[model samples]
Target: MQNDLFPTDAESERLRYEPFHESVEILDLYEHHRSGEMDVVMRPLGENPHATPKATMDELQSAKEAWESGERATYTISSKSDGEFVGVAEQWLEWDKRRASFGMWIREPFWGRGCSSERAGTMSYVAFEWLDLDLVSVGHDPENEQSRRAIEKYVDAYCGQHDAVLRNWLPSNDFGDPTGVHVYSILQEQWRENVTTAEIATIRVGA
Candidate 1:
């Protein structure tokens, strides 16, 4: 059965992470994916960090297929001021559990701009308010201090709790060794209490 709570299309115009197909240029996205810096973090997560053009296209197509199948939601992050590609945001849904896990990767040059926090706010709104999911969660590689800090800030703001580290939760390197992850989650009720109306007003979702 199709889940009516899942949005077929959604975006945050003010936050700058819109629907992937609407704003992402394949070559531009591929360029970022192939960067050495990106590879260092993403490759361990099973992403083709040094992806070729064809591979990047195939991955995008695969994500589209997943979206159509009601498996996940993915968005392209761009600069609203200039429309420059900056990153990608993802939500992996577990419908039966009413939970969604979030993930993202930003370009090196765009780091420290609070893009992660904005994406977190908008996606939380989508998961709880738009999708009516019971829980939203995110995890980070233990060694990635930048991601850990960014995730902690938004999770704290949303009144989320840090769950225990899950050992061997993700691939640690290209060789497929295991690594632990720091998990955090926010319940729908917590979001209701902490996320203000003004913050929600800044996000716009499409049907």
Candidate 2:
């Protein structure tokens, strides 16, 4: 019964390629390289008290480098959101050719604006068209309904489908509902008819 609702890549839809980027400011108000007044940028996907800006900045710098090159990884979320850093999103390529996985995080102040879908659509499009990739994947916990909806929109835009549900995927990880991991993905050649109508638009300060 559940299998029918959630299908594999072969039974699901794919997406056409597109280009995309998510932007953010370099600093928060205190002249710090952060994105919030509460000093919350470097925490895990869920909330935590021990987050530090110094650690996040270090990781983010490395993430930027990894993204610039066609490496085996993307970004891990290091964010605090009062619309200062605008949040983070990154994709990666692997040597195994299994599937490219993407992750996205928006500042709390700017989460509902629908940037998630737009970024995902554009990135999915790019991965399929330019990168010559096979599949794209994304995941979230069951307790995070907002994140779940965002992932749904992204996959919907890219015409992606359900992957495996990694039950109790990361019990040790701090992210809530580790047992309820939900994965979604799609392949190339499924962008016909525009299932991706993401409304979020990207704007550059100088360009």
Candidate 3:
């Protein structure tokens, strides 16, 4: 377990990505879901750690179904180099594009490397630029400073009040209990103002 170099494990073999470009490829992430070597995978907090279970073919199918049916977008969180699987992120919008929620997570090693922020920023960019949505939202576990710090890193990209929405709504992957979820958002007009520099930089972060 070297600190500087990425491991030679199969799960660590990832695709290549430039320093300032996005290399988000999710196929292998779904494939590498069985190895719970990373801190963040897909977990429904405040519920069963095994509630939705790990990512699988059926899970992908269900996500696809939900996307197609809901007319929303979803993607697997993949690291550029080493191709290590991280987490997943998606967007959910409501009536008239008035509001939309953004969610993302990553393995502990990849958390602060800006992948989550990258994905979150990408989600925001897409929602405002591509989908022409009205507003974008993100919810973070209160007690999870890492999650909160990640969200706050690019807080400028979003606007509106940072308030608690679902009290004990999300499953806490820790003990299988409902944990409070704090929500943040950015309006279309606000995003337009903050869209000046809306991109993430990619680098070979050590695990």
Candidate 4:
């Protein structure tokens, strides 16, 4: 439901990342999920807001289940200085396609600070290198320019077709706005070509 990061800051206080674990604070995630900024970023064209703490916790638990089931991979984005839950990144795999679709969302306070872009880079590395997946796909809503720009920052790394638009691809919300989704993808061969200069370093995920 969220998107991209800034790569200039390599310091720990600026950002650090780890795979989502049971130790992550559910409340912190709940707050991010319910914030007005997240609502707008994730649901500007839609309206299924998680209005309660219980619902937020349930959603987190469900995500954990999905991760454990090997259906997807999820990571917690945090600040090293305080280890705060600033965001999350995920790769939802489509086994049939041998592709993983990356998704991420940063806390409202962390927006514009490059958290999303960092996570995006990490997601690509893990999918293309660690997982040895065939392809990586990412997309954003047609009207979400912020998301568009964030995702576009990685264009050189993937360089797939930019004109692939799916009409009404996403379900309409109460507002019934344009649901066309723009998709970008990179083949495994392309990733291999870009890995040398992609600045990819593996983010360890423990069993």
Best by lDDT: 1
User: Candidate 3: global Cα-lDDT?
Assistant: 0.54
lDDT of 4 by residue, 67-88 (tens): 6667776677778778776777
lDDT comparison, 2 vs 4, better candidate: 4
Kindly report which residue stretches of model 2 are placed more than 4 angstroms away from their true locations once superposed: 1-53, 72-84, 174-180, 192-207
Clashes of each: 0, 6, 13, 6
Local distance difference test scores for all models: 0.79, 0.51, 0.54, 0.67
Instruction: Assess candidate 4 and give its TM-score to the true structure.
Output: 0.80
RMSD of each: 2.7, 10.5, 9.9, 5.8
**Model 3 compared with the native: what TM-score?**
0.67
Span of 10 residues, lowest total lDDT, candidate 4: 2-11
Residue 106 local lDDT, model 3: 53
Off by over 4 Å in 1: 1-14, 34-37, 40-48, 171-173
Q: Model 1 Cα displacement at 101 (Å)?
A: 0.2
Please, what are the lDDT tens digits per residue for candidate 2 over residues 1-207?
111211111100121111121132223312433334333433435444234655545555565555455453332122223213444456766647746787765556656776677557655654664466777888886667787888887677656687777877766444444455788878765653444333212211110
Clash pairs (backbone) in predicted model 1: none
